[model samples]
Target: MTRRVLRTLLPAAALVWTAAVGPAAAAVPLPIDAPLCGPAELERLDGLQADLDAKAAAGEAGRAQYWYVDPRACRLSVAVLRGAEDAHTEGFVGAALAASALPAPTSLTEVDEPVDRRIARVPAPAQRGARAAGTLHGGSAIYSGTSGLVYECTSGLNNYRPGTTTTAGHCADAATTWYDARGNRIGAVTDWRYPGTDWAVITPVAGWSLPNDVLGSTVPVARFGKASLGEAVCGRGATSGTRCGSVTAVNVTVNYPDGLVKGLVRSSQSGGEGDSGGPVYDGGTGLGLISGGASSGSPTFFQPLTF
Candidate 1:
C-alpha cells in the first residue's frame, strides 16, 4: 500500500514559512559586474541577510532565492525568480538594508530559472546492489521506505567513515531511513543540518559496503576542497545528468520557501529537481553537494564541502 501511494505522488520534503508586514524604502537597481566577496564583507552580509529574511516573512517583499555580497561591485546582490521583480522590490530591498543599518543593495538579478530540491518519485525499477556505480551512479535514485516513494538525487562522495556517505541534508532528514537503487535498506540519516547549511551523512545498514567512487566517475574521490571564483567545476544530478560550469560566487545566502540557507557556493552550472545531494567536484576532488539551482539551464547553488 505504501509503495502504491508513493509511486503515484511526487513527494518532495520541504518546509515553508510566511508572514505579513508593510511597505519599504525606495532604491534603484544596480548592475551585476562586481567581484565576489571576501571574509569581512561576508560577515556584514550575514547579519544583513537575517534582517532581509525577517522582512520577507512579514510580507514586506516577495521571497528570494538567495542574496550575497559581491565584493567586486561592493554591494548586495539579490536573486529572485525571473519576472518576479518589480518597483516594490527595490523599495523592499532598501528598507531591509536600512532596518539592518547595512549598505543598500547594488543590484537585483532575476534568475531566469527557479531553484528547487532535486528529487523525483517514479515507478520502481528492479532492485540491485549498491556497488554498481554505472547502474546506481551519482544522479541515481534514493529510496526511503518500502513504499514506492523514491527521491531522485545525485550521489555524493564516500566518507570512508565506516558505513557512511554524504548527500544534501534536504534529501534525507535526520532519522529518516534510505535505500539504494536495488531497494536494499541503506541506512538511517544519522546527522543533518539545514536552513543554515545543506548537507547530510547517512549510515549504511549492516552488510552493505559503501563504495569510494562517485556514481558516474571512474576516479575515486580522494578528498574535499574549497571552491574559488572562476574555478572550473562540474556536477552530477539524476534529473539533469552531468553538467559543468565555473564557480561564480561563494558565501551566499539562499531563501527557500521553507527557510533560509547560508554559505552556499554559487556557480554558472544549471541543475534541476533530483539533482540535490549530488557531488560537485573538480576532477577527483570533491567540492560540495548540490543544494538547488535555476531550473535546468541556469546558475545553481551548492552546499560547500568545506562549510
Candidate 2:
C-alpha cells in the first residue's frame, strides 16, 4: 500500500502568472463537454466488472488488472499488465464490452510496470518538531499498530456517531489498533474494504471526539456526495498538507501491483506519500478519500465516499 501527504504549495512561476492574467482566468481549467455518468450507468459498470472478475478467477480469460468507466469518453476502459494480453484476454474484453451496451474503450494502454506502493517507507518531514500541528483533526496524522510495524496515514472524516471516523482501508488492519501522531491511543479498525473499494471506519476510544472540520482550514464537512466532472476539489493529508485541484473523471478503476480498486475519482491534484486515506472535499461536502497518486504533476485517484 502507498500513503500520501496532501499539501498545496504554489510555485513562484504560478504566482507570477496569476498576477499577470488576473484571478478570473487563473482558476483551474474545467473539462470541455465531459460526459457525466448517471447512477444507472455506474451500476451497470459494476455488474460488468463482476463478470470480468469471475472470468479471470475461473481461468477462462486473462486477468483484467483494472477496469473503469471514463465519463469523458462515454466508454469503459480496461488495463492489462504488459505481456499478459492474449487471445483469451481479447475475447474477454470483447464479451464484456458487448454485454455492457456501452461504447468501447477509447484506448487500450498496456501497463508496462507494476504500480509501486513503496511510498509507505517515506517519512513525512512535518511529522517531527511540530507537535502543535499534530492534533487529532481531519487530515491529521494517523497510524495503526505501534512502532516498527506501524502503518501511517491521514484521518479522513468524522462520522456522525461521535467517536467514529473513516480513512483508507489499506492504511489499517482490522486486528490492529490506531493512534494519533502524538502517540495517543485513538481507536481501532472496526470495518474495512480493500482490493475493491478502499475505505475503513475507525471507532475512537473513550473521551476522544471527532472534529467536523479539516485541520489547518475552515472547510466544514457535513455530508458526502458524488463528484461531478469539472468540479473543483481539495484534499488534506498529513504528508502533503492540503492541495486543491479539479475533477478530471469519476468511476475510475486503477490496477495496482497489489490488486485492483474501482469507483475512484480522478483529479488533477498531486499527492505524495502519507496522503492516503485523507479527505477529498469540495467546499463543505465530503467527496472521497485519497487512495494514491504518481510522484508529481500527475493525477491522483480517490475512493469515492458515496460507495
TM-score of each: 0.74, 0.70
Cα lDDT tens digits, model 1, 141-207, are 5665544545555557667344577788887752277666666666677878876688887776666
- lDDT of the candidates, in the order given: 0.65, 0.65
lDDT (Cα, tens digit) per residue for candidate 2, span 165-242: 878877764234767765667777888888677888888777776778887678678877889878999998778888
- What does the lDDT read for residue 89 in candidate 1? 65
Q: Pick out the ten consecutive residues of candidate 2 with the lowest summed lDDT.
A: 14-23
- Residue 236 in model 2: lDDT: 88
Candidate 2 contains a number of clashing pairs equal to 17
Badly placed stretches (over 4 Å) of model 1 are 1-47, 53-61, 83-91, 96-105, 128-140, 160-162
